[model samples]
Target: MTDTIPNPESEGPSGGWGSVKSIARILGDDKPSPMVLEELARQNKPGGVMCVSCAWPKPANYHPFEFCENGAKATISDLTSARCTPGFWSDHTVQSLRGWKDYDLEQTGRLTHPLRYDEASDRYVEVSWDQAFDDIGQTLKSLPRESVVFYSSGHAGLEASYLYALLARTYGNNNLPQSSNMCHETTSVGLQKVIGSPVGTVVWEDLEKADAFFFFGQNPGSNSPRFLHPLQEAKKRGAKIVTFNPVVEQGLVSFVNPQSPVDMLTGRETQISDEYLQVKAGGDIAAILGLCKVVVEADDAAVSTGAARVLDIAFIDEHTVGLESFIDLVRSTDWSVIEKESGLTETAIRGAGELYIQAERVIGVYGMGLTQHSQGALNVAMVVNLLLLRGNIGREGAGCCPVRGHSNVQGQRTVGIAEKAKLIPMDKLKALFDFDPPTEDGVTIVDAVKGMMSGQIKATISLGGNLVRAVPDQKAMEEAWASQDLTVVVSTKLNRSHLFPGKKAYILPCLSRLERDEQASGPQSVTTEDSFSHISGSVGKRTPASKHLKSELAIVTSIAKATVAPNPKLKWDEWTADYSLVRDLIEATYPDQFGAYNERMFEPSGFYRGNSAHDRVWKTEEKKAVFTTPKQLNALSFDDAEGRLRLITMRSNDQFNTTIYGYSDRFRGIEGTRDVLLMCREDIRSAGLSEGQEVKLVSDFNDGVRRELAGLKVREHNLPRGTIGAYYPEANVLIAIDHHDELSKTPASKAVPVRIEA
Candidate 1:
């Protein structure tokens, strides 16, 4: 085995002309800039604000170029003149449309109006908004409260998300699963349990001032390119940036800032990570544990010898609990176990730890790589423990930062969207809206599929997102969806989820964040929260693709009014009329925190929803941040079977969540394909496979059912010996419904045991 994999020679620093080329392609494919100049002008004419792509906090002083390449693609895709009209649907049957790729389906165009699937004709026909809402209302009234569930996407605004949650509860159901369940549920659950906060404590400004940053399980280059700016600035300022992952991401390798003309023109690049360690899949716990062990040993040695202290004794003693027990677990853990699990030598772990020991201020940032595991929650908690050792929390340029991949995932949760009832009490709802909310736990994504399988949940309403394409065990999920009595999707474009029709299904078109949403009062502005808990306003400027399309808030209010009628106190109509009123209600529900929601939202930089952990004010039962001792290190174990390997699912640079932007992942040097499996050369040879050889992958699971995907091409890469990588949604088939984080129910998409056959 080699100590380091050879870096590709063909690769160049990110954001040279490559970003311009990609953006041009996106604009060219959807609508040439010249052709859609009017649409672009309409979208940014006046009083228009905020980038529609991501929830990254904006600067206090706004600029015309606040958007990024990805943001441009997202905006162009939304405002595309191409239309998926009734004629287009008539020409392409549902079965026929299924053959088109996810990107092609979306590229076909913006959904023009509400549509309903007609089984007889095998096509979707246009329907009046009134008729669609009538059907949704009737179906909700027909089913038992427990049998009806509402799902939300992270792209939704705070006002709409709040209304959706309120509507679901007032209608007597708490099955409000969201896209966050698949991504950042671990952050919410783990942080809340440990520090009495469910969101990241550090803001964007902290990254600029940090002395060091540890990035784990996240690829900022492809996932969020805007992040590259701050990372590059930190690197230029001499901050040590360390990365841990199974694959080396180019964006983290080197970035030539596109925003900086000098760097782009001169080919000057800023190297991002100081050291990149390729940890095994699900090996984050072991790796962090080993690093912590090194730091603790050095600190203990220093204290016993009466040397200067390495650990922050005062901070730990005053602000944390369970330290002695946590220290015992880390100290007593054998090095051999850590070595075997982490796929890193003791020297490597200690080398990384030395940075922590030397740094005056440190910030830790991670993505799904830490959260998409069976022990995902434990992974988050362990990171918190690492920071606590040095008084990292409650300080500038230092704290825990879980890079929420989605735009407003943190905000969606804050607006009271949850599966568990105890988390959001019924009493709070009763006082705020004068309605008795449900008081029982509801089904999450996996459980919702189970309910459908058992003939319990008969209907579903998705605020946004491609649920069928996003969940695990696609075959089972598709079967479960097929058995539903009714399914309704509120969306802006057509995707794979709409293809899986229940007995009665409807695709209701809604205005996107980039389009002007005119309510009864006037053009509406909605608020979204960033990963750092800053809530800012997003006011679209373009006209709706179709006049018939309704706003998400309006759709929710209309449905609520029709289904849960005779309730005047709820004021669903008023909330839709003026979004500020919705903010007022949110303020009432969370008085101390959202007390000034409306005023703060309009502030140029937005305002932070104070995190107790940021101020060292732990609100836990112990009145201090608690150190959690996980039961074990890694939750996955591969069989001794010869060809067995740990397989992890990931997104390409061309994709966002389940939305496939294209077939190429420019960062990984992969072009024109998503069917390729990245594996170490040794592993490929051991499996009797050559680079570019076609093979079949079968997942190993406790369930008797066999889940396999064939015709996958093997590609030699720098992954760990026993680990392989594949794009998600396509590889989601390998993940079993039962394989998820127990605490948060997040699917272990990053680690799955499997076998490959030539």
Candidate 2:
């Protein structure tokens, strides 16, 4: 039997009954019994807690219904009553289950026991935690420090990340490959170079006060649903919302506030984007430079005509450097190059610039779309450059806002999870943990992949995440994982990565973020940082899916004790007992920002890790926010055969990172399937192809390796000409791991020139 694919809707409100129906479907399907449903409801109620989904800071005055549809799905996904037993694994061989889809694997429910792969039986059998830890410890201890790498997922809490960092450094290995290496490494590198901080300067509340919002490569409706509320509010208050993306996302086009009873009942929708510029894939850098060019030219006219200057001359003179060079580059850039590279007319670019000039305060928001390209760092710098010109930084309702997709990705980085050992000062580790940390830099996700192929990575300890599936070049990633001597995955649910075992592999089931974590002290709370650097405490109410499941803190502590020779001064055991102690230690490590950790942790309003750029306090070497003079925008070349299209990998509404919730993408009108590639009708005709035609896509690579994805159905889309959009992870196979950004090492997943085959 074949699956039926639904047609894409031409128009609809972002969220209303669609969100409600989705919530019902997920929760009802996952937890059928009345008793289970009641328990799930109890877990979702607001009682001074945080949402388990994306890390947008909860307001000081909490609403009873604070969670969004995605949050509900994420929470219920963890609240699932189903459990995978040892008997279940015995019935299915690893090779047999290899045919399962990502959603199918997640639907198998929580991992109920610690299991180790047995070569003789070709199956995973239940094992004691001590036995698993012992094997892992012995293997790790035997290997040279450089041979082992610690890869962390962003799903874990701050406490676990801090402990994991300590464990890695103490074991004399600093090779920590993190999820950030895949997602926002460019944001960190690019923003840090200019503002001395990688994170966004604007707070959550600033959105309400902004006069205009320029969303670049972000769809708040899907990636971060909580943000839609703020955008809706900003729209209601007469703020201009401009969008620049390859695809016209439903969330950015129009939205019906699910929180509003009147809007929900009447189907009254609020138009989101006043201007939607559909830039070509990998064209964001050129588009932003073009906008800067308009602003610079406008400022020049304002100076001559005695009009109010668009550029912030006072702020530029006092708080920035290299403005002249930046303006010169923008001026010298050709109009034809901007138009061709951006896939937008000069009139449109200039019009958006006019909107910027008209507004007193503006916020710039972007996502992975800008940072998943070869020129990702330059793309980020361009956004910063645009905002810097108008004095968007150092003011309320105006700053660069990078929407962090994961719930705790930013928090993990805040609490000592970094590839660079020096990112967390040695003095802090020495004073707090009393250990002389390794000075050598650690490997990132990209580095780990290269290391694995060369047999440099002997063992791997993963905290959470489907690491193999998330990386590009799927076949290569799987082959590399098979070469490891020991691979340990500390996880809650079953994923594709667990099936591909090393010579010795162990699956250590851990408590989900939605489950209550009780320890020696009492119910524990973990902290997470939002995209805007607001830190809040989240405590789950649901009972553990399995009594055998351990908290991440406990898992890390046990591993640290078994592997690293115990130091009386380290206090790993004590830290596990009460997470507040961990927060206290974290505060001790960074006393200035995290002072009074316990008190701040309980703050209903949460604590803000202040940004120097927002306050006009530059920490740069020049003692000011540096105006980066990027090279002039070059005319983009697809360099592919005439009928070829540039493909940009995208996420479905039902997906978050590699976690597939359902088959449908409600926003894009894709239902019941992820096998379709969205293409422009003209491109389809140009290639002499028809809609619903099955074809193979062969990626053009610089490495001379043939990477082809077969059996992809083409569907007509409203995409810009010469570009196509396909679901991520599935399309990730086309991205060559070696084809990555030079500065950030992030795979160029957003831009892949491909030729269609019959």
Candidate 3:
């Protein structure tokens, strides 16, 4: 095939120095200085220096080579020199900024001061910190407790997250909606149904020893590049790696290790996966069922032939429940239906099953692609079933691994950040502060958006996210924000959320985690949990951009103090003044894993949390892990109707979640734009379309909600037939709120069926 992929030159500086470095690495002209300087410049942006999440405060003693291309972009974008002062907001009305593209808004600059909407001037005006706090407090106090919602993004530090949760619960409202509700809530919800916990069952070390690794619906190259190292190590160790996704990601196929001097100098890329299976969009369930069916058949064959027993009969008999039912379901599943729905032949399914059976230890890693479908919860249950069938759980090098996005999303959940459920920590709060906490389940992100749209939620306090851009159904969320009684956003940089102004909106400037935070107590070291559930200390190397800027912890504390009278028992002031105290409380709350959080975090390598499943100590009610049998066999699929294709949304290498680092998506040949869509050669021909054709894609869901954009040249990719991919945020306009997993409330951005009009 001709290499017509667009050259990196067409893309802007959005990739910063990392783009040049990646290009050099790709072309075998690897030079480190230029890229390093570019990265340094990117980090030393106006407000603070932003490091890639992976590069941030490593174990103080270890020389870790865990950074990747996407990690560099995340760091560079965080450290950009952009600044959006109150003067800028004063000059530009909410209506004016709303006209700018999402990238333009964020790239404008970091927010320098707290701002509040001025009705007379019809623009955001700078306000005193005290005044901003008072305004927010008064508005919140004026509302019925149930009418206010507190929302969190994944980027916030653990301290900030803990405080945000504390503020909402202390205020007698559990109406907390967070970013997790939009991403892996399905894993939590589904896993909780099967296992007792919501977090992953595997540890990082488990990858090294696993006999086989199953990657389900996860693309690590762009989303979580840090995982590449362990995966590469596993590949080198002869572990059979199987990748199942709707699209074939190049990163999964091969990855070059930049950390190895020899490999970097030689420009040799390591072959990653042993096998790749392109399952249909939302067809993971079907593919998993087919695997289970193969396993059942293999077990039956082994028993009949008196060869070797493929089934872990002893493990199943002693450790699980519902095997008979699961076995029956798998035995009854039709191979023809499984093959048609999963887009995989029975042979391939049987091969994968054989690998699973032969392997002594196995691990299944997944991402949002598995959690954002209509049957997302069920999909997770099916994965557990496969592990259970093999007696994989509660064993070394075996269990489920959900590669979470954002820095501290997992940490937030670990430290009682949920709105609906208060852990034992809340009892301590009651004992300390003497306040009766609300016991009602709080709202989730989806419910918060719905509540605002329905007018039941009158005021919103966004601790750190670009709510409108990050949330699905952009138009509806924008309308909801506009109609809210008050909208308050605490952030470091300018973003799309700043444009969605309420009648009374306030933007509070806060210190980014990379900026040194000092108060009367001392400088603070915040903590974050990695994808592997390792909690480490992150101390800022740079000074805060403005004297007025406070830490998120301080900002949240001030708001709580101003809004609610002091509850002597809880001592919120003590924890807010020093983040370590917050960590102490975290330790107390999760004593099982985080005992002595401060001392443990001081370790340079950081510390791992408890993983019962990894130790084969299942925390299930029966004291054993149970395999689940899904009621259905087929995965979700868009009908093969004329002009319709399955559209999956993806993030560019230059972007992190909703934060766009740059416009270029170098891998798929698209440069300088995220508006383009990828399609198969036959689909392009059948639709009478050519490369660079601008067309409208109307959602097959919600009565054809049409979104128009200019299409770029179509490339013949390894993507499955009738499937298309587009960059998110830009393409988020096409996802309808109604089209999501019913159980998790996660928008099905990965599998929206659409029709293209040229």
Candidate 4:
């Protein structure tokens, strides 16, 4: 079946769900996957099944009608009956495929066989698993291990990620450039710097007991729907849930819990946030500073009037430091400056502060929205500062929560994906494999792209992801791809990455987590660590898409054997043939937690990885949770210019990350078209544009790139002035490579300044 691109003109304005034309434009010209309907059927089955996308098990605790709209869409996407067999690659050359749209490319379906780029034919031809591994091994053997960079995506399983890291380390390079570097690296960097750990200090259960919840720059309704339930519960309990984001996300203000039986049956929706404050773009640091100022003022007044105690004196004196400096900074800063910088009035800032002071416990939850900014690290530290003031850390229902995107992204970092100049993972690899791993720090994702573009790097082996679309400066990334000697992609379906093949490119099809993994022992179960540090078993419920397709673990093992001589002490074949052996190796490597990895996962509900922060055991050198003082008192704010606005790139309700599941974002009233820019009515009128006016938004970055998204209809959203919103992947073009957090190297996707043109 030939795929069809949707016409952009047929899509209507950005009011409530645009007309059919907009849907077509958003989906491009691709035909609906036959698997979509099939997947929907499975989703609506009597007993809910596991989603193949995130490996999220069907929660049994909730009512029968527990699925969210996005969950249903994710299930349908996995069930898509698209197939891109070896013949399709044989028919189309890499050059020809390059011209195809991203939607059409993925619509081709799951790859059926291992394929290698045949430069002579200019096409990807089918190759046997053995030959493919042997060739990849030869390539690795030929190059200095430092030259071979292993890139991992969030979509990969824990087993696959572990193997990828092992392969790279075994081959003598720790150059593991991963997807996390682009997303939540700021959280890891900031939290570690302040609290001496990369993970969040709170568990999911803590959300329920918190008196007040401070949500910073995250829209759970669209990003992680599962979180909506907890927020809903918090709201129902009369807890004040305050939101701080540039855009007034519908999910944060109110949400219809499709999982709640009464809400689903009666079409009832619950209010999520008691107070939603739209802070200026890139102004999180300022807003937080303003809030801290209010806290400090309230405490001084309380002490003077003898009304009530504002400061947690006992907790502060026992567990923290730098209180005097923090208070001094807050006192020194004036309300006028804070209001100007945060775009929030003194009343709103004080009200937020009053809520914080009155609450017995408060939990601060944030996502990439808070981390992907120029002052991302400081913003994080500021949030930590607020918690420290209240003695929130290591206490019940009060701490820091960095809501990670991928299911196992955090776990990947924990296992050994560090790109730091100094870490002992390489030394551990040397002890385990009896081979000296590279001591030199490896390139991160951005660094790898720069290296490839500058001809310092030769080959890139991506475990699973659409790297080209995910990274910034697509044109530069494409150029870097053209310069590479070889580019290997291990994936289940065709994506934008497959089209951007190098001179010699290979596409190796692998098994999805939902598909049964048949090893010599039997069906295997993989474990994933969620944002809360809960390690759960993921067992496949569906049959393999194709018998020829190999498990990612098997493929990685084969490649590893082909690349290096087997260690006399370790049995690589045994581990590959049985996943238990791999688990045993992991348990042996990290004995502190996974002493008996196989036994623990078999339990119906898996175990929680011990979090030292959960019990208030501060692991800092001083053995106390330290209060970090903000370097600057004023919040970071941008000035509004003619035709210029600060644009925040967000996911549509129907989308997740780069995968455009469907065109309709019900919450935003955006339908069919993904190109529409969201701007407040006043901002639109100020720019001399009408509701449905065609316009070009040019980036204010040094690169001076322009994105032509025509005729965006203006909606009177309760967003901050001088700020607008756009969907990602498309808007990704507007973000420059240099616009990144200094400490974390995370791209500032949330704070790109742009101007609309007629």
Candidate 5:
């Protein structure tokens, strides 16, 4: 046994002297001080660099050093002094590098030059950009456009993603699957069905107008620490915050803002969540359903007594459809079933719902915890249903806020990075590019992985992401990834996905967000959209890491120019030389959204791309938002399997999506390891297991295929009896690739059924 101890206690309240020191250590870790310092000072400011980390919105009245520890880590990690040169490539082979950790691989640092995988030596060799681009372009042109998938990551800015989408469409395909496909695809698909919009319906300032906040399946304390400031402010102003999660999170409990002088000087901490409910993993919808029953029943009572009704009759009658069915569903649902599934009592759930009923304006916030599940769409739909009951959609400080994880993830989707052909305006595309674009539905992440496995996907052109690690079924993904004909990745630093190269693999070096991207006109400023639907400018001031490196826009343009034959209407070089042309094309493409293009984005406060749902403009068939119901409430609602547990894959304090900075999880009081399974003591006894017991996890999906992970040490936690928590990507091995939500096809990382065996 490893004898690794688990500390369920948090290190301290979120963001104190500890977070600052953590950031300091990373900045001091072989990074150039002056450049990094200057970059930090200008980060998330007017005419400043947008964080390449989380998509949390920035404040208009910014703090002097407006950044979280995670932001600093992301910046320092990318602007590293270490460089991956041709010599470094020779030092490590493809097969040898597979065993390396994700953190170690990225820590080796940025790729200095474009490189191609050599079969004979099993190594990557330096290649000129011209040859690499020509080869990749020729191969893409040779294949049927449907066989190619343009995989864009969350890191790329608006201009690059927009051009990348155009590159895919003009080359004759709609197979543009990006990061959002895996994370928030559920939110997009579900919300669009209900509200006619695929994004959230709130601005950052809306937090100020709220009397209460109901947070579910989100941990901003770790993933998006910058949000703590506003939550802190909200709590200070006596706004009630009700949180629902599987585990105790430090930020939701209390917070000590690093930027606040009083907090640092006096060691004062602000309490965050007034009511913290530890609902079972994937029971958010069930809990929400319970809440609905509470509100509807209360409304009936209020009507009889001639008091204020709990449900908003006017909004429900005029602005929504399927109201009767929704009410019927809520009334028909039994409290026994809700309590059984939600791992919460009727009294507890009603208390939380009462807070919602009392507050005039409420904000409902959620994250991947609710989205990465079998009923992920239902999870989102239920929240909307709850909000609509109180006429919350168009109200100030009261709406649905799906806090996005990575930077520009939403902007990518907004600017046409989608697999659905209908989502892309075919008429506008035909008129603008003057080419016959593919109108067929393309592969999503799940379909793409399946395609690669079955040898249908011939090529994958990634703009920036650790796809293999981010996806499920690790063993199969690696096999299918290496089996492909071509795998092209454009990135600033190396990741595990790069190690599993195809037969003809290429790692193309690109400019980081920290470096100046100068085009033919002069220096350029790229724009990124945030969780709030706000767009801001990012201008990198640091020097380029390598002279041989090219901007992502330049690389994508080269490939497109080489692949597609000369078009008299297209100006590839001109657009690549001056990004303003790309922005102009964006303007023509999304006139209402990006009008004025280059000018409005640089405004000090940025600009909010208004949400129609927020303005009470329903873009659906009947011009009204609908109340959606779950087709089937499966394993996520409850798991009754004997000797089984519901597994939720989570990130630690020192982690991002698929990127674990160190072995230690800062807030969780864990150090030097991430291979431990978190379980409540009762569950351990029930399973005939002891603390720190070495065990193997077996997937219990009843599928013919066998999936097991050995050597994970068990650690006691505060989770519900039938639920266990483990680090994401590490526990991802136990989840089958096809185990996902039916509506959105989002991999159910949060609600896998598994068992521990000694």
Candidate 6:
């Protein structure tokens, strides 16, 4: 069970029968019947449940089946008939359940009641909703405002997210950290500083018109299967596609649309990437530096010879600042260093650069691979720098698209989920609520862990997310979490995070995204924002898993009402009765941002909440797009130390963020288990190891910590030299809690220093 099986790798393209089989398996095992197909019809419709899966934008036009294989898995997971009722909780102990794998722990089924950890019996005992809320309020009231951490996740829709943020701010705590703190904080921090926009600028309709795409550090096959359709469509239109990553992903190489009748009938896959460059792990900066070097040098040659200029000279002079420093940095960087650091030959970099400059319009797409690193924010800026060289942003078919992973994470931030006081306008909040909100910066996931370990934070109220499994230094988080005074989780199902019961812990069950959320007003709809900034509405029609479960809006508002002294100005009761009032408050706080919030969210084709950068308007202090100069060239390219190998933690095909759906990784061809290490043949031979050999991986960092992950079986891959890959959550233990980007405070989970063993 511990060792991964060496199943034959899929020779066919991504997403053909494999996807169909997975859909069948998930539906047949978890939810048997064609009823799910009927639900799928209403999945992304104007009045239906939103797929609480990956945040890939729903298409402008709806199809028969609007969801993907993983999306179906997520839906089936929520709508499964199996339930972990009161009897199961009373029978199991937290200490025993902690030993279960993430997959098994979740497969136990949906929680049916609000439960409190009883230390006397060492099991979770069912508690009445009224008593649980009252006891939680008492604990929070006993603690200092600064000592409480209100952590929200992506599962809750916009109304719930907005309420959760308001709850935190009203209680005088600015510590509103969510799942975005792990993934796209770099995108928010990096893109805003450089381009005056925090989100992706490209939409699917416009992206279809692009002449070429430059994909950096994203694996659509595993991370986002829905995105592969666009890549496939673009390829069919004969648009050039180039990819840069340490491993050659199957989806980027070739893909067969499982839904396409012609594809299924012919069994032919459309070629995806015109060119694939195997950049070394943590070497994206060097690769991007090389790209800029090409375009900059080309521009210099054009200027000298009076030939057509490669750089967008007019755009540079008019729209942006810091061009001189950017040019100087690109020109001064050594080609040899770029080639060495990127682990690609100079010829390869030059060829990729040549291809890049030929396209009139391009879409630069990236994902966690770019953001989860030591220089993550800088990594984002570097991509923007390259795009600026060709005037890619604010154009017809070009811009930086940081493909977000978790669902509604961007939407959560759009409403109010932020740590910094400056991000949200406090003056507007004060004007509407008649009460001053907290202005102090809040603790991030990293800081929260440290605070918990030091006994500085006493209480935790989570909307959703598995904190114990998601954070760096897994052992440390598990140990530190239980030291607090109280812990409360608002979720649909049980997760590893629920196991960490402090002095008093309660798991408050909430209605799942697809379940009907009825208030006094009637069944209500919730809103969610996608990766491309499109707002949409979802109305859940399914029956509630349990009558005891409450809506997140009710839970958050009730908690706020009980914990914080009643504010006469804020209508906690009315907001829960009708969500429109909540939207009104949100719009009032930022009138220009979410004006007419209720009317626009449910449009047949969701409206885009436009980014200023898309219109060539800069929101920065300088009122112009700025070029970023990195403090160090090719920083953290991870040049090898004596026994070190650059380790890249990746997600399996059946996994989404911290949630592992199954044991098999269909894309990489590993089955039955996730405990495996994948490295190039050369690395395996050099390390004196063979395929299927069970080996240990010891992380090597200079922080006086050497973390070891054993029971990992070795398997040769086509990955670049000196770099290996392992499944995440398992490998999360190797990352030190302190290893993160200073600007974003995002844990560097993508790349770590490790040494392989025999």
What TM-score against the true fold does each predicted structure earn?
0.96, 0.96, 0.91, 0.90, 0.97, 0.97
Query: Taking the tens digit of each residue's C-alpha lDDT, what string does model 5 give over 178-223?
Result: 8887889999998888888899998877898899999998998888
Supply every candidate's count of residue pairs whose N, Cα or C atoms clash at under 3 angstroms.
0, 0, 22, 20, 0, 0
lDDT per residue for candidate 3 within 172-199, as digits (tens), equals 7888777888889888788776776677
What is each predicted model's overall lDDT from 0 to 1? 0.82, 0.82, 0.73, 0.72, 0.86, 0.84
lDDT: which is higher, 4 or 5? 5
Question: Can you write out model 4's per-residue Cα lDDT over 1-758, one digit (the tens) per residue?
Answer: 00121112222212112222333343343343544344444432222233344323223244444344555555545545667888886568878887765656756767889888777777778888888888888887888667778888876656667777878877877789788888889988888777777788876567778999999988776666667777778888888888888876666766666444576456575766767777888777778888888787778888999977677888888877778987877888888877877888888877778788888899998888789887788889899989888788777889898887765777777667666636445555667767776677888887888788788888888888888889877777888876787788888888878766776778899887666788888887676666766566666656677889988778787888888777875566787777777777677667776767777764433456677766766677767766767665422333455666788888876666777766666666666677677777678777777776666777776455553444454544556788888778877777777778878778888878787777
Name the runs in model 6 displaced over 4 angstroms. 1-8, 32-34, 635-639
Q: How displaced is residue 344 in candidate 5, in Å?
A: 0.5
Residue runs of model 5 more than 4 Å from their true location after superposition? 1-8, 30-33, 631-639
Query: Candidate 6 lDDT, tens digit per residue, 1-758?
Result: 11111223654577888888877777666662346677777887677766888888788677777778778888888888778887996568889998889888778778899999999888899999889989998889888999999998877888988888888988888898888898889999989988899998888776778888999889888777778887877877878888888877887877888778999889887778877888888888989989888888898999999999999989989999998987788888888888888888778788878988999998899988889888999899999988998899998988888888777999998888888888988888888888889889998888898899899998889998888888888888888899889999987788998898999999999997788889999888888888888888888878888888899899998998888888788788999999888888877876776878888988865767788998999887789888988776543535568779888888887878788788767777788899999998898888888999999998787778768899999987888898899989899899888888778888887788888766
Better of 1 and 6 by TM-score: 6
Error of 4 at 31 (Å): 12
Q: Is candidate 4 or candidate 5 better by TM-score?
A: 5
The candidate with the higher lDDT, 5 or 6, is 5
Against the true structure, whose lDDT is highest?
A: 5
Q: Which scores higher on TM-score, 4 or 6?
A: 6
Candidate 2's displacement at residue 6, Å, is: 18
Alpha-carbon lDDT of model 3: 0.73
> What TM-score would you give candidate 5 relative to the actual structure?
0.97
